[model samples]
Target: MSTKLHSAVEVGHLRKVRRLLTADGANLVNAGDGLAEETPLHLAARLGKADIAEILLDSGADPQLRCRCPFVNKFDMNNGRGDALHIAAAFGHASVIEVLLAACEPQAPDADGYFRLLDLTAMYGHVEALNLLLERCPMDVSVRSQALCFALEHAQIECARALISSGVDVTTPRRLYRPDGKGIRPLQFALSPYSDPCDDHILKTEEEALELVKLLVEAGADVNANATIAHRFGRYDGCDEVSILSCAAHYKLLKAANFLLASGADLNAKDEKGWTALHVAVASGNPENVRLFLDAGASHQVTWNICTVLDNDNYKFTKKWTALDVIGMCDTRILDLRVSLDWKKYTLIGDYTEVIELLVEDGADIEAKHETRYVGNTLLHSACSIANLSAPAGFKRSEFENGIICMNTTIQRLLPTVAAFVKAGANPNCLNRFHETPLHVLLSGVMNAIETVSGSYKYHHAYNWVEEEEKPSIQLLFQCICRTVRVLASAGADLN
Candidate 1:
């Protein structure tokens, strides 16, 4: 057995190596090839040859022999500090894993100081093999495994279920948030049961994911639980920062949204920003959600300004919506009351029909105008003003110049509202304090840009940093000229 046994074992010719060892029926345990620790059992275990392993064990080979100075001793590789169990586990041979676990002494530390059986099994997704190790090995199940994390990341549901059932606290806190803190919990990872939407990784099917979500929710996991713990752990994404209900709202999951709401989730709860659930629904442009929130008593007047909540934020935004200026057609007292009551929390549902009916029932003065202080422009004016037109004077010239907001492109900004007002009988030709009509007020001057504090541009919290030109509203002037031309043409007024 000069070197024939060692070379045959090296090449995995286990039967040949064993034959050479037992040629004279020598005890496999004591059979060594010149090397200090080159035992026949070591060869079989090193190569993960279960057949050879069984043969050597039956032939009186000592299973617990430590191979001292038998192989490469590269200092870089932790001084070659590995054993037969390490080799077998690394190769993922169930039979070899079983043999090593059985032959090793009870609580005997592997050369690495811990036998990570589940870890190895999770890594390879060897379910059957893991089951064997779980049954036979006295390994600690509490050790955090890269394999477990990988299984979750890849969404191997079967493997994850097994690990979870085997006493893995899914919400174990891990340190990822503060520098010296205990860490974040595990349930956070369960927040988004799907893989990266931007990536093409098919982590889980929709049905499978829904089932998982249902199971997690049923198992005392808060369906509306704040998943910010994951965000604290650096999983920075939309899903990580919101509760399940918020996520459903963001993704337009109507059923999920309703379920969360019915389950007593706070609809008015603000997120990291001061945005309530109703705010999100409107910003999402989903009319269904718009109606849902309104019916659920969500405030329509609250607006987000610079990510901060705004009071009395009234605006009905639709492709063909009559702007809030229509509220001017409503009773001033009612408007005052709505402003005072923080009506931003309520949204207009179903054409504001209910709102209109309620106002009618309250005997509201529908024709009341903000002629002096509030500048009551009507619904039609608001609508056309959004198209960049001006409100008609509807008063005398001096009053138009002072009260009509003719300067600073006020007329242009109020164009849609002006048109809405005309459509609602605010009088397109109503004289201002000056003798100029609505069309006359529009033709006053050219426009640059206006300075505004809490209007449409700033309502959504956008920053408009461009410097304003001192010029007046030219668009209004152009509209006025066009209107004059159209009037002269239509009324048979002769051009000089």
Candidate 2:
């Protein structure tokens, strides 16, 4: 065919294309076997020329011809890739896709080949084209599930719904990824704060997120199914087995959390840490979420795992913390719950005064202190051991200054937290096995507490080796530590 014939198709000159096809006849229309050789019909399909594509197909342009394009990954790479179907689906030309489907001689290729074509349409989020493919090329459950995975991997929600409606079982214990990659299951993904790296489309509204969660549950998805976490963080950090309700709480997906609760989800389910949804919600520090779980019958009596970061970085003491202790030990907005690893919450500290007050008012044990089952040390004595802080903050034992944080950065919230604990009637004079009072822990963290303690202890929390003259930050840390000491004294912290 002449350039004018191709040009007419390019500019959508339908009549001119008709005259050219008959004028030149079928011999020149295809011109070659593979469109990689630039067959006229393939170009028309690729350009979304639906009318022209029909004309070519009618004029004996081979729809079944394989595209010999060197970009095999685009069209020919898959097992049973269709030439024109692949091109038209990629550009999302539903009309053209329909035309080619009807013209397909041996019918659409087997499931595997069709799925490769689906990848193009699904990734581009072409819903209509996807529906057309599904109808023309029926897939078995395995293929349908693979197609659903493709849709979700791209956040193609509309396509995913279509696949689910087409019977892609959501209950098969699906896991998306692991430590080596971004991983989570279907229901967990919908309720998670983390988005898959490949997702271009994501859940938009609270209603949408909640709806998907509900949809998955209705489709035989088990809320209590235990999926190995893709990558551990948040409430499920150290736990490999967990419930969907706990996941909702961890991400603060309040709508989903409420929906799950209404749908018979186990509200107070405990995993390896003896943590319930209430504990996850508390650790998340969203008071509204905390209240939600609490109102829904989640327990305040549950013990949650918490790390008390001391001035030292070596002695990481994991203790059974009540919701109240979580307020003291970490931030409300949990950015990283590397609890299984560093447990560094790496957060911008916020005032927990109101929330702590709320928890205490709600009967959260303000005095829910205890020695670690193994360590047998109270929060203070366990906190200030020189052996634990001896390292150069390698274990991040003290989250207060994990290289990303500095001592002065947390001073404002620090004072309020101490006041909240003291006001809640938590005993500062309570002794750990070491027989030291909480005042000793405070003095041990900062060498001196506001210069008000009857006398200074021999040991100090601040690094004395770093010269205050060389760095202004070191001097600022000293000032903050002194202020922290003052707050403890004003709050009536007792020396043992």
- What does candidate 1's lDDT look like per residue over 205-321, in tens digits? 444444444444444455545544232113333122344454444444455566557767677765544455554454333445545656676654443322112234654332211
- Model 1 TM-score, all chains together: 0.40
Error of 1 at 145 (Å): 9.2
Cα RMSD, each candidate: 17.1, 9.9
- The TM-score obtained by model 2 is 0.62
**How accurate locally, in lDDT, is each candidate?**
0.43, 0.58
lDDT, residue 68, candidate 1? 41
Query: Which candidate leads the pack in TM-score?
Result: 2
Give stretches of model 1 more than 4 Å off.
Answer: 1-13, 17-93, 102-125, 133-150, 177-187, 191-200, 229-241, 247-268, 275-496
* Model 1 residue 411 distance off true place after TM-score fit, in angstroms: 31
- TM-score per candidate, chains pooled: 0.40, 0.62
Candidate 2: pairs in clash: 35-38, 177-183, 312-389, 445-461
- Local error of candidate 1 at residue 232 (angstroms): 11
Report the C-alpha lDDT of model 2 over 391-472, residue by residue, as the tens digit. Answer: 2232233322232232222333455556556665666667665666666665565533222111111122355653343212
